[model samples]
Target: MSLRSTMHIPAVPAFLDSVRLRDIQLPLPAAPDPWHRLGKPQPCTASLKLSYSSAIAAAEKDDVSLSIDYGKLFRRLETDVREMAQHTSSPEHPHHRMVSVEGTRREEMKASAVGQDPRVTAGIVANCGLSLLDETAAGVRRMSHLRQSPRNSFSGSQAPPAPQPADAGPAPITAEYGRCEVWLQLPKALLRAEEGLKYRSVTVWGYNDEAGADALESESRSPVVLEEEFRIEGIRCYCILGVNSHERVEKQAVIISLGFEGPGQLAWGSTVVDTYVALTRAVAEKVDETTFQTVEALATFVARIVTVDFGNERVTVRVEKPSALPFVQRSGVEVTRTQAFFQSHEVAHSTLATRGEARSIEVLVGPASSLTLFRCPKQAALYPLEEPFIVQR
Candidate 1:
């Protein structure tokens, strides 16, 4: 995709506070290490600063339910980190004493160490943090720091050396211990308000209560989106996509762009290129079967196909109608959809019917400044009552 043609939004605001965990232990993989044959997990220290937010009311009331659960997050991180250590080998590990090896032995050693790769452990942070963010009371937060201990070599004849920084000058090949450190700062906006609210009756440790509605509004007005993206660009199609009389009678030339983000790797033996081809075909087929009065509808249709038919975790679809106006080169509409969006949409529609409340419900997506109403069917299966009445996408 051409960089010039893509849309860019600079700096998505992240409203949050931070929790710090220093010097926690990590485990090693269970497999016998080619280097550390001792087969026992080593203990290491880890420092992490987790950025999160609690409701202004909850923070004031000292409600743990509305706050991030430090104990739970710690246990999860501990298990993941230790498993990575156990299955992997390091030059400093007890088993990896020799400096040189050749042929099958070298290959076997590398293969055995695959799970121990730094990237593997890094993924623990990337995959785990989002859900915690969702659980936070204010709903917009981030993880600012992630670090793991270093690996140092040790000699059998000497006492294990003291733990050293990963960036510290090279250590002895047989050194035993290393240290991990991570630091992240919460967004200043949240901190500023937190500092203002102090009450003699209650001690609010991590957040403030003084700003009141303004603070809550500011926090709710800006949300942080952590997205991984894939794009399909410059696909040309013909559609009846406009409100004008001339546009309805004739098919107009349009350009389409799509981007997707999702968790989980592709199924084994499948490639991204393969997925793109299939997605393109599905989009083309949908366009052929439908007629739209506006670019927004066309874009929404494409987004639905990617999310529903293709099972994309999330998608952004843009449809550009060129020559709609003589003076203008082109104009388009863009729409974003996600799995959570569909689920919430279904719930909202279902809630309206069963609760016998309002005749219809309009879902507002994102922050207050830019909101889109998600359209849903009037009739559907029973929705779980446990679903929140207000669904935020």
Candidate 2:
């Protein structure tokens, strides 16, 4: 006899493909040094997570040319950043060249009077991680704006451009009295890999002005602004969960990952610095005591803390169970919610966790079959209401 208990649980598509680049150093010029001093190129990190939208036809058909080479993507990012940094955003005072390491040559290349302009400096610095977005990878793959050389892009027979005069120098780039604060999330990337520039520039710059240099972005709009994207990856915790009797008594490991966007950039006029360590600590500690029965409740609780308690404008929370299924690697729920979303909807934050009782979200966990949300209202169109039905871990 067959195990006739498998429920027809409808779920989101699984086993999606993604290409990633982790810990790539982004050289930030005239930014704060490790010692808190200015006028140095502080090296920062950027990570990319590009997921496949279509059926990943290249992999299915066993075709090499149809696939996007990770190596080419890596090289393209490096080249585009270098080219962007080398050029001034404005056409009025153009002195496009690479920022070098030599001490004195940097000084000579800087124009004293103009080097003080924060707008010009921020524009150049922001461009390092900034790019436009499109609906498909074809948009980026076919663009010629970011060619190896601007002049030679048109024809191979063109003469090399003339050299600049000794007196002509690059614009002023100083991190002394001001800074160029921008947060472009590769996490900000959407479905398809489209755009010649290969990325989208959302203005996460802390600067008060919304119409700053980042506004120059063309094409599609980002899901959120470009202020700093905060994250706490690999949050491992043990919690009681499941429908089985053994699972009710024992605790199982759950993996959680969270991402958020902070408020506007404000210059902290102090010697010490602030960080997301507190936010991470707070979320982990609260989630540790959580005894939710389903990954859905756990994920929603995490999103609530980040958006309501931590004051983040928006948050994406993912909670996964490694032991939920016998053959499957993990079963999980991912939810994205905003501060405004919670304010208007009371049910968004009504699930309370107390020391007195055991509780789990009233969710449907049937397998590959019809789904019925026990507690969700018929009109609930909010994120977690009809959340991506069990996005695989």
Candidate 3:
């Protein structure tokens, strides 16, 4: 039976015709811990869906052009994800090299302005689990998983059912932020795999091939969401924040929890562009430099800093003041913002997008690392340094 003869089925939406790379499991970098031991490669799974309008016509003619070659796509995705997890994003303030325990301990003590500070010690200990990726055998297993699917490609399935033009509407280019457990439906299309193209097996959501149709049917029944979570916890800092004048006289303890929501290549062992440490330090420095009358204002400011500094799709900032009230257990504020929030606020726009030149002292660390010292936006005369800072746990 030819694919052209399979036209008894109803016309599907253009968005429904796409090449999907799902259930991709790869090894991640180990957590940032000097004391951490390198173990077996730990694999984490991620999914991707893509579409090209010209694929339908190309499949009909058995032409390679315009159709997505999923075998090639998957290979590229694996390499890109691995590279993304390996490199440190910041030019200065590279992460401490994972080496001897004694060297790590020495560095830890040196990092704290006051030798053996309890808070600093706690911060360093907490950062042990921060890496998102770990080197693992999961890559080998993933390759096998990709190959397990039967080779039911769109090439030469005896011609596609007539010719169907893509919809004139704008392409489905969207990025939504939410906590949902479901997979996005990739567009269904016929692709002409290159001759001798190894790993041609693709697990399509809906297709009746020698591959398990029952399993595919089960998957087609429930779609998946395209999003992941990035978290930073136990971020403790001292800031001049309080409602009362007495409280404003001295610095109080504040713990921050940051939850980043977005769609991107996130590995368990890779630093999300050193965001966890960078943003946490930025929040502390921002809070320390300025006095806040309310927790709401502090939370809002931190949220804005996170959105701008990291270029995250969405952020949720929770500022906890454990010793705010004598009798109360804790008092704090939680604020959430999307990219749209910064776009809407004029102050946020300037804070994130605007970078001005001002006189300040620059400090060189080691042979390569250097700090770009500058004045805070609100306090031009203060000369508060925003150097790359790290805190692991």
Best by TM-score: 2
lDDT, candidate 3, 54-134, per-residue tens: 244445546443344567655654553344323223222112222111111123322322211211211221111111000
TM-score of 2: 0.39
Q: Which structure among the candidates has the greatest lDDT?
A: 2
Question: Tens digits of per-residue lDDT for model 2 on 88-192?
Answer: 343332222212111001222233222222223333433332221121244433432243354554765776555557655321111111112332222211111
Question: Which wins on lDDT, candidate 2 or candidate 3?
Answer: 2
Residue-pair clash count for candidate 1 = 19
Cα lDDT computed for each candidate against the true fold? 0.41, 0.42, 0.39
For model 2, how big is the CA root-mean-square deviation? 20.1
Which is the winner by TM-score between candidate 2 and candidate 3?
A: 2
How well is each residue in 45-162 modelled by candidate 1, as lDDT tens digits?
Answer: 3345554332343466464554656787777676655555542445333122111111001123334343322222333432234234444532322211111212233445565556
TM-scores for every predicted model: 0.32, 0.39, 0.37
Angstrom error of the Cα, residue 11, model 3: value is 22
Model 3 Cα shift for residue 337 (angstroms) = 1.3
